[model samples]
Target chain A: MAASTLRYGRLRVVSAVAVIGFLLTSCGGSSDASDEVRVSAASSLSLAFAALGSAFEALNPGVDVVLNIGGSSLLREQILEGAPVDVYASASTDTMAPIVDGGLSDGNATVFVRGFLAIAVPAGNPAHVTGLDDFGNEELLIGLCDVVVPCGAYARQVMSRAGVEPAVDTNEPNVRSLLTKIEAGELDAGIVYMTDVRSASGGVEGIEIPDAVNVAADYPIAVIVEGPNTVGGRAFVDFVMSGVGQEILAGFGFVTP
Target chain B: MSRAQSSHGPSRPPIAFVVLAAIAVVFFLLPLIGLLARTPWSDLVSLLASEVVADALVLSAIASFAAVTISTVVGVPLAWVLARVDFRGRALVRGLVLLPLVLPPVVGGAALLFALGRRGVVGEPLYEATGLVLPFSIWGVVIAVTFVSMPFLVLTVEGALRNVDVRFEGAAASLGAGGWTVFRRVTLPMIGPSLAAGMVLTWARAIGEFGATVTFAGNLAGETQTLPLAVFVALETNRDTATALSLLMVAISLTVLVLLRDRWLRPQ
Candidate 1:
């Protein structure tokens, strides 16, 4: 019995070590490279920043640009929790406030671009949604971003300015998720950025919210103070504010700030 | 129950085993310690009393209890059929039933949406016939939770049914008891402990369901949002409120487990 027990113990230890070795190898990728610049950008900037990242990499050889795209508020929370992010770009200045207040940014965030809210509906406009006034129609299934998110805040502003009380069915976490539901026909209409409607490439149709009631969400970018590659971070932020970056933003239907 | 019985059972575990076990215990304890350390003690009462928390609690209770009731109604019969009835492709049927247990809840939610959403294959006809939309409603929350939780009940009860002695049931039937009476008098009593365990586990899983509920049901306060969804939204907007909610869930779960320790944790 003792002999068998000892053999079992030896086998268990060997397997444990093998498992640990496997995990270490799988997790040890690009983390030790000092030339990598990690940028966390808002999901709304996905297309614009993908182009920007490639352009920045082309200009700076041996410097890899990695992009982490998510909701602006979520990214801010992660940065506050000490995520190793070199650059941060948000869809709204409100989300950047926490980073600035926490002293996590190297300097004040600069407004890079602006986005306008529009009513997004599935192709063919199944609900026959015409304007912001339709948002108050309880008959249609409408979605909006959560109140805390920038797009949601802008949408709420636009609705209030128009004096339309929207019968919101669901509050998605971000603009992209809301757009997805609209595209899927799960939602009849949603409040999303003009850029998102463009990004959908006919999967959805956009009903323009009159400029008189629309709110332009200011996009901000900042370099992290404690990021490992502050130089690269600053360069990326500068590139975003440069003429080329403005062109890319314009191409994606954003208003250059 | 005595030291002498434990001494005769086996020799002391190997030192490596004891060390690894200790590490495992610490791994589980550390997270609880962190949660307790960060919990907002002073604001907890007020936070708990907030409208968001109150709505979420009531919704969670309604959805989870509804889920348990539905699971018990359908899952027990399925478990019995799987354990007692032999048929072609039984293994395939069983695998289909257990798929949600292994699939990510998000994937499960997406699948549910594809099948039940407004534009879904059957949903379109169903909606046209009745004008009954499921998503973003309380019914959606219950359905999402039930889809993810029923597998636990089915697996638990099936295992118990398989272990139950068929002779006792046969004897009861031979004494002129009907099939249903035999099952109720003999088979059910034999697996009573496991049935209770399965119901408790189903309730726990239903309450903690997040990914599927959010993805399929969508987040709407006082309608589809449950405790887990409320906790997630709070995490992004208010950390203190999120911590307070987390502590509340932990306390409630621990109390339930402790209160029912003898029913399922120990075997007679």
Candidate 2:
């Protein structure tokens, strides 16, 4: 009786393994499709591109546009490492340079939009942060994107131009994270794109930096050369440069390039 | 013949099991091999000598050690109580203790922030009372590491305590030894191996923590950026530096595992 019971247990285990194997193989096989256009965009483009993605989808039915948004440098690294990205939109031309140099993209990346830095503080401005000079206040907790990211570099440029030495409390991995901290009231203030402050929708308030000290970030969009869906990739890039796309971006506080 | 076979060990006749195990081993080895292939050996010393690497190494060491120390002081007693005492909602208490083990570290970090961040539930009051802030500070790193690592120590020590023979402690107590003295003189010595293993495991987990530490403590060099956070940041800007930091972490973890091999790897 015990022997039969043991054999029955083994049979159950083997059948369970076989069923799991079938499910895994089926899942993998179904997910790989040329109709899916994977676009990797910078975090700052999240809301704008999301709107563009839906509008593009509505124009081109049967082609699903999946958006992968993250730090511009991080997305560039992923593309260079061979992530299956069809469209690549970066927050700065600096991040786009490597992709073009590596021949990962189609070599012609048009500057789609321009962004400027602004001081972001939690709602009600508890720290009373007014300008770039207040970033040097040691009593306040200040956050900035990591220096490698475009936003961080731009923020530093603005701070240097304004002659303010920021007393940084943390170097967040991405602009979104810096914004999150500011919105959460964990950070007294952080330097982020003007669009990000608008996206926060009252969670945080923005203090504009003067035009002289502010550096405009050039956003570039291109189609990956080796992307799985090159045809769909080109279409998406063209749509982004279209008048409707520009209008959508402008509504998000981005300046037309 | 069956008795002799049992004494030798259970017979391993399953070819499928052996094949699956080999695949599992290769799954772990491939990443290490990739890291090794990409590691820049010539620039390793200089990379390690750089200020960023040095600051991260020092901060990681300080936070990990502090985490282990705090876990030992508080976790051992909690484990003892769980193992020795029977109370209502004991299962619930055990579940709460194991929650961190199963929780995604990022979620755990967010939870910590909600409770201890500068404007957090308790943190606002704490700041009002003492003018102290935890996020983006070294203390935040230590606290985040400890919150995630303490469970390992607690689980190990509790298991050890459950396996221990209480008769020895009872006899010692009957011989005029106070409860604390009996525990210190008898229970501790008996569970020393497991305790050491638990502490080592806690230290390993603490040192390698990334998601929680980055989320709760924030990544700042010489303050909250542990080795894992440094590795993540370096990966974006400099690949070689990231590889070097990863190799250093692997070496540290390997040394700890090898040192505790007798207690953990070949448990009798």
Candidate 3:
């Protein structure tokens, strides 16, 4: 048994070496010789940041801006794992707290924009969803973001305050996923950011949550102190907080800082 | 085979082989060790007893068992046709059957949504007529798990079916036995070990199925949220809860593999 185990162990080693060699070789020639600034942002900023990245590149000829977007908490986790991100922009300060404490950020994080929650449904409101109260109606197929994210946290708070424990079909990982499911008609309705509804435009209809129960999501951005390109990272952060950038965000229905 | 492997007789092992082997072991085992070292051992029991863990565990077991059963009933016939029947495009069909083995599970889930979701191509028509939707339901979880893990059962059973000698069936037919009798008494016994092995593998894969299930069925507690989905969500908020849930999965998977290793891998 010992001898057989040893043989299998050696076989595993052979395969492991093959995989490692393949990975190392696949890192082929770097695509950008120019200084590349990597920004890890929330999925909510996908459209907004794509515009910002292009404007930054057009201004700085020798530098390229790369945007990586996903759920805020997941992005923060990647940064904590030493991801080579120069700038970390999250939908909420809650997700950015750990990185700041770890001293990975250049300084205090900045709140750049705030997103409001909305009841997102298919165009024409086939589900006939009207107010936040419908979120508790078991007959409606509802989706919400998980509590780990800014949207999800706000979603839960709003639902609880409205005295409605929603019968959630799923807790999506990100705002974009919730929007996609809603657009696909897989979900009758989902609680997502107003900006997401604005981004999707014709694909979805946003029912504004009443001010009495509506939640405001604060977005935070910071430059990573240990990023590969600190100068480029700082530049990107400044550009995002710029008036021009704020206007671009406002066009997407984001409340500016 | 044992004698062949024991042949240290011809050449000495290379030094680089030993060095790389040690590195491989460390690379694979370090994360496991780290997880164990940082475990809130004192709180593990309480964490396991929580309502969320219980709900997820029950849901996972029910969905996985259903998936394995469905895979066995549906997959065995497909495996038989692929292995024993000679037809045009047989190789292409075989490759297609094994597609899920390599496809990313998340992509598989999205594809399922495109096909089975309410607004999906086929799903829209089906929903309009039958008022039945698959996503965000227990059935959706079962479908996603079955889609990804059934390939394991099919490929294994197909290999077993191909290897069994045909003469045994012919010899049995020469006697008074009918087709069903011959198959039940001969073909089945011949592939018993592989069948058992396939079911065990299928069960393990279904239980651990995550990405596809999350994507297709979603992450709703007591509905689509299985153990893996539960662990993932917990990982964001409560590390201790996530670790405890992960430990449950690791322990279950390890026990299954350890207890059935010989049955699955031993020579027939």
Candidate 4:
């Protein structure tokens, strides 16, 4: 009887341990200091932000920066969904305006750098696309960023300004996708940020638009109100708007806002 | 009364089955009902009529069908070998076959890129020999879809093959049936429902495939943009377009399930 009782006690202990293990595995996950800081930024700011992130990490002793690049709309959704993000930057005032209005962010957003939309052609200027008017060629395959993105909004601004109804073969999700098409020679021309052209590294050539059609892109950033690391978040945001940030942004060919 | 006896019985199989079925029905049907509920029916016809949406639908259907066909062709032979043949490292091969499913779809895409990109190992020779570039094209979509989806076909068909009687094959051989003939006439006929079910699963998986296709095929509209990719692109900027596209995907998937229900879920 004592042996049987011991056996039952042992079984209870085993089940208890298993339950604790299961709970620990499923719930109460690990938290430790790591180099990575998750930054959710708009897709249009990917090039500029990546360069800035690398430079920021270089100056900082141990902290590393990782950029989660996607549509500003999507990033907003993620932030709303309680993703573990430290910094949020967007491509447009319109996109950023909503985040600010929703009271989900702390501190007012500041525009650090500005970019203008330009027509990007394949390397060596294969299409010899001279100006925005060059996009009117029906034979040339033009890719545009979809209208929801800041880049797309800029492109539409330029097209409407020029009063040209150019044929668009594809509407990509981000500026990088448009750049990829231009680089592949699949698209004769695309509209992307001037900074993106610098990042492309000769994969595509940028054709500046006339002032009349050129629409400036503003980059806005804010800290999440409910972030676990508000200190790190605010520090990162300050570093981005600092002279160091300006240098990094300029190195990527961004004009000051 | 008969009802009282049934209810009071110790083993209430019918009642248990009813509860399980109710749970299953709610599990699958609720999400679809949610989609229908959220659908902007007022704008449905116009959204469907758009050329971009039409192109994506057609492309998705074609690519998914092609993916399922290729998976079926390759997976069946691989399944037969796995189930029937005794070979060295058979367990290793089985593990490798399941590698893609276990892998994150994005990683699988990157692996495909390394193997088949313009600067890839096989791609360099392939370009020189046949002037064929595997990445950034429609065929690349097929290859990506096939890579991630073949395991479903293989696992299902392999399970069916294992349960089939080997004595039938031995009898067919004694009756002067060649190996190929016996497989075609005897084995295939037995596993026909299994193959059908596997193909349906494969088709559904391919339709929903997004990561590998986007990475390998580069998401050029009318080229590599399947419905999922198109919906992703739409969701980036336009919430309405994304919702409309998602509703369409839900509708078609449900239609396929209903049409193929008996074949998909019938007991062997």
Highest lDDT against the true fold, candidate: 2
Estimate, for each residue in B226-262, the C-alpha lDDT of model 1 and write its tens digit. 9998888888799888889988888888788667755
Candidate 1 fraction of reference contacts recovered: 0.32
Per-structure clash totals for the candidates: 0, 0, 0, 0
TM-score list, all predictions: 0.88, 0.88, 0.87, 0.74
Lowest-scoring 10 consecutive residues by lDDT in candidate 4 chain B? B1-10
Collision pairs in model 2: none
Which pairs clash in the backbone of model 1?
none
Candidate 3 ranges beyond 4 A from true positions: A1-34, B1-24, B125-130
Candidate 4 local lDDT, B1-268, one digit each (tens): 1234444345756888889989978977897787677678898788667777888899889888998888888899999999999999999999898777767666787677667765467765786789776765688888998898787788777776776777888899999999999999988877766677678777888898987777666666677788998888777656668778999898898789667855444432
- Residue pairs with clashing backbones, model 4: none
Cα-based RMSD of candidate 4: 8.7
Question: Per-residue lDDT tens digits of candidate 2, residues B1-268?
Answer: 1223444355775899889989978977999999999999999999888888888989999988898999999999999999999999889998898777667777788788878988899999999999999999999999999998888788777777776678888999999999999989998876776677778878988999997888888888888888999998998889999999999999988887786765443323
DockQ each candidate and list the results: 0.28, 0.30, 0.37, 0.15
True contacts kept of 4: 0.17
lDDT of 1 by residue, A1-257 (tens): 42233334333433443353345335335584788899999989999999999999999999899998988998998999899999999999999999998899987999999999889999999899999899899999999998988898899999999999999999888787788778878899999999999999888999999989989999999999988899999999999899998898899999987
Off by over 4 Å in 4: A1-38, A54-66, A80-84, A119-141, A159-167, A181-189, A201-212, B1-55, B81-144, B216-225
lDDT winner between 3 and 4, please give it.
Answer: 3
Q: What's the CA error at residue B13 for candidate 3, in Å?
A: 7.8
Flag the better candidate by TM-score, 2 or 3. Answer: 2
